[model samples]
Structures are given as structure tokens and as C-alpha cells.
Target chain A: QIAVANAQELLQRMTDKCFRKCIGKPGGSLDNSEQKCIAMCMDRYMDAWNTVSRAYNSRLQRERANM
Target chain B: MDPSASGMGSVDPRLRHFIEVETQKQRFQQLVHQMTELCWEKCVDKPGPKLDSRAEACLVNCVERFIDTSRFIVKRLEQTQKSKAGFSESLSD
Candidate 1:
């Protein structure tokens, strides 16, 4: 249940971010180029999330070891 | 009324520990979401075929610098608070 909620939150943020990045100006409908941009944005967002997570985790570990 | 029997003390220690760990994990996930949004803007110009090496490096540095900024703010605030307390103490004396 916790995992599900976490995933949902991630999905919500990703959608928000991708929409902002891909849609410069909302057209009549979702254009092919916009769709492609969103797809790429989603992938990059996930990659960024993973990178931040790893960075934070290692920092915590280093701080703990220092303590 | 026995407080231990009525409240959190009644829960098993292992369960309590599990809850604490889960809460910590949730906080970690929350921060990751926030940092991703922040760093995405700073590091990512446009979504590309992949996260290029330069963008990847920027994200990593962004995370490090963000944490450093947080720590610096906290330390600065503590220093100010300490000085304020000392100022008040001296005034009182």
C-alpha cells in the first residue's frame, strides 16, 4: 500500500513535469511531436529521479559513517 | 489507567521499528521527488534521446549542491540564534 501510494505520487509529479516541458503551447490536439517529447521527458525524469535517490542515499551513508 | 497498555507502548517493538523505518523511507522518496523536479529544471534543457553525460553530471552536482545549501542555511540559522541569545543574555546582565 505504501509502495503503491509512493508510485502514484511519482507518476503525478512526472506527468506534471512532462506536460510542462513538452507542451509549449497547447494546440488543438496532442501533436505527434509533443507526444514524442513527452515520452522522452518521462524517460529522462525517471533517470533524474534515480540519480537523485542514489546521490542522497550515498550522502546519508557517508554522513552516518562520519558520525 | 496504564499508559503503556493504552497507547503506543502496547505495540510490539519490532512493529514500531518497522513503522519508523517505513516513515523514513517515505521521507526519502518525498525528497527524491522534490529534488528531481528542481534539478530537472536546472540541468535538463530539453528531453533528449537519453540523459546525456553532461546532464547526468549536472544532476549529480545539483543534488550535492542542494544538500550543501540546506546544511549551510541550517548552520547559519543556528549561529544567528546563538548570537541572539547571547545578546539578550548580555542585555539582561
Candidate 2:
């Protein structure tokens, strides 16, 4: 249940972000280049998310060790 | 839900632990989402064929610095509260 909710939320956020990043003007339709940009943006967004998560988890582990 | 089964004691301890761990992980993921959106703006000029090395480094540093800033704020607040408590105690005495 929680996993489903997280996935849905991630998708929603990705759509919002990718739209802003890729679409300069909301024209009649999503052009081919815009579609391509959104695709790449989604991948990079996931990469960034994982990178941040790893960095944060390592920091948490370091703090736990200190305590 | 029955009144007889109102408390968490009714739940399996293992399941409870699983929920707790998942909740912690979700919190981390949620923060990552937020920070990624924020740092994406600051670091990324354009989405390229891949996440560039510089942008990747920026995202990592952004996460670390954000955590540090939060900890610093919390510590500063605790110090302020301690000093205020002392002042209030002196006034009451």
C-alpha cells in the first residue's frame, strides 16, 4: 500500500517537474523534441533522487556511529 | 475494528517493525524528492544525454549541506531555549 502511494506520488512529481523543464510553451501538442527532453529529464530525475538518497543514508549512518 | 483489538498490541511485532522501517525510508525518499527539485534548478541548466559529473556532484553536495543546515538550526534553537530558560528562572526567583 505504501509502495503504491510512493510510486504514484513520484510519478505525479516527475510529470510536474519534467513539464516545467522541457516545455517552454504549452503549444497545441507535446512536440517531438519536447517529448524527448521529458524522457531524458525523467531519467536524470531518478538518478538525482538515488544519488541524494545514498548521500543522506551515508550521513545518517555516520551520525549513528558517532552517537 | 473491534473495541477488543483497539491497541497496537494486537498487531504483530514483526509487522510493526516493518512498518516503522518503511516509514523511515519513505521519509528519506520524500526529502530526496524535495531536494532533487530544489537542486535541479540550481545545478542543471539543461537535461542532457546523462546526468553530468558536475551536476551529480552538485546534487550530492546540496543534500549534505541541506542536512547540515537543518542540524545547525536545531542546535542553535536548543541553545537559545536553554539560555531563555535560565533567564526565566532568574526572573521567577
Candidate 3:
């Protein structure tokens, strides 16, 4: 379905961006340390995305309630 | 758009509207990703064992204030333009 494709595309973009942010150079087969760092980075990135989304949503809700 | 939509050669208004909203949400999500990345470099010292409450709070406040700052600039610019235009109109009379 289109939704699935959209998700895959977004996931791909997210991974690429995060990988570039976390990985400096292509080391020997993605060493354990690199893998761990990437894993953690991905989680933190998702956390950041969620926090922003929640904050923005609540702000919109507050504005709507006020208006 | 949906493959079905392509096959049908037409997209329903309701589906189109849904897609529009989803697109807007995706843009918001993408900006959040970008901001988080930028702020992480500034506010995050290290990849903790987990994101501490303090770090999470920093991100939330960063997002809120970032938005506030954007709106503030926009409104200020609008007011500036309004005053500038008012001055020009009065002087030209």
C-alpha cells in the first residue's frame, strides 16, 4: 500500500540522516562500538522527534482552546 | 498517492485531504528531527545510558521556545512593515 511505501521512505531517510550524524567514517564492518552508538543515536533521535511532536501538538491545542 | 489511486486515475477528495494532512504532519516531524539533531549537539553532552528527564525537558522546552521565537519574529516583522507602510503613506500625502 501507499502508506507502507511512505513509511519505508521515511524510515530510509531517517536512518540515512542518523547514520550520517552518528557515523563519521566507514570503519571495519560497522564495529560493535559503532553499532552501539548508532542504536543509541536512533533511539535518542526518535525521542527527540516525539518530544517535539508532543510539544507542538499541545501548543496547537492550547491555542485552539484559547481561541 | 496510492497505487490504487494511480490505477483509478483519480484520487478522492477525502483521500486527498487525508494525504494533505499527513504531508503537513510529516513536515512537522521532519523539522522536529532537524531541530532535535541541532539541539542535541548543543544541549546533549553525551549519549547517556538513557535520555534523562533533564535532557527530555530541555528538548521539550527547545521545541516550544523555537516555535515561540518563530512566531515572535513573524509578528514583529509584520508590525514593522505595517508601521513602515503607514509612515510612507502619511509622508506621501
Candidate 4:
């Protein structure tokens, strides 16, 4: 249940962001080129998310050590 | 007591532990989602074939600096409140 909810949230956010990043103008349909861009965009977004999570987690660990 | 946590009579000890761990993990994931969107604008110009080294470094730095800035602001606020309290105490005396 938790995993499903998390995936759904990620999907919703990725769709919103990738659409904005990849789709320049409203087209008749999501064309081949547009589809390609969205795929790459999703991959990069997940990369960014992991980088941030790791950085934040290390920062929290460092702060805890100081205390 | 939280209504959500009220029904604990039948909840298994292992399931309770799982719930606690999952809640913490979800919080981390949610923040990652938020920060990714926030930093994507700053770090990424366009989605490329892969996340280039430069953009990856930028995202990492952005996350660290963001947390640093948050801690700095909170410390500053506490200092301000401490000074104000001291000033008011002196006035009362």
C-alpha cells in the first residue's frame, strides 16, 4: 500500500514536470520526438531525486554527529 | 492520542515497526520529490542523454546548500528571540 502510494505520487509529479519540460507547445498528440524527450526527462528527474536524497541524508547524519 | 494510531490492540509488533520505518522512508521520498523539482530548475537546462557530471554536481551542491540555509535561518531566528527575551527581562527589572 505504501509503495503503491509513493509510486503514484512520483508518477503524478513526473508527468507534470516532464510535460512542462518536454512539451513546448500543445500539439495534436504526443508525437514521437515528444515521447522521447519525456522518457529522458523522467530518467533525469529520478536521478535528481536520488542525488538530493543522498545529500540530505548525509547532512542529517553530520548534524546528528555534531550534537 | 492520534485517532490514526488509536487502533493498536490487534496491530502486530512487527507490523508496527514496519509502519514506523515506512513512514520515515516516505518522508524522505516526499522531500526528495520536492527538492528535485526545486533544484531541477536551477541545475538542469535540458534533459540530456544522461545526467551529465556537471548537472549532478550542481544538484548535490544545491541540496547541501539548501539544508545549510535552512539551519542558518533557524539559528538566526532563535538568536533574535533570545535577545528580545533578554531585553524584555532587563526592562522588567
Clashes of each: 0, 0, 0, 0
Residue-level lDDT tens digits of model 3 in A1-67: 4557545655775587668766887876887887888788777766666676788788879988999
User: Considering lDDT, where higher is better, how would the candidates rank from best to worst?
Assistant: 1, 4, 2, 3
Please write out the lDDT profile of model 2 over residues A1-67, one tens digit for every residue: 7778878877898899898889987999989999999999999888877788788889999999999
Off by over 4 Å in 4: B1-20, B85-93
The estimated TM-scores of all candidates read 0.86, 0.82, 0.69, 0.78
Candidate 2: deviation at residue A67, Å? 2.1
A8 Cα displacement, candidate 3 (Å) = 5.5
lDDT of every predicted structure (CA atoms):
0.90, 0.85, 0.73, 0.87
DockQ of 4: 0.74
Better of 1 and 2 by TM-score: 1
| DockQ head-to-head 1 vs 2, winner | 1
Query: For candidate 1, lDDT tens digit of each residue in B14-91?
Result: 998898899899998888889988999999988889999999999999999999999999999779868678754666
Residue B43: error of model 1 in Å? 0.3
Q: What is the interface RMSD of candidate 3, in Å?
A: 2.8
In candidate 1 the C-alpha lDDT for residue A7 amounts to 92
Which tens-of-lDDT digit does each residue in B1-93 have in candidate 4?
A: 867677865799899998889989888778777888889989987989999999999998999888778889999977987867875467669
lDDT of 1 by residue, A1-67 (tens): 7899889998999999888888998999999999999999999999998999999899989999999
lDDT of 3 by residue, B2-89 (tens): 7865864577779788887887777766666567666666556566568889888898788778888888999997788786788556
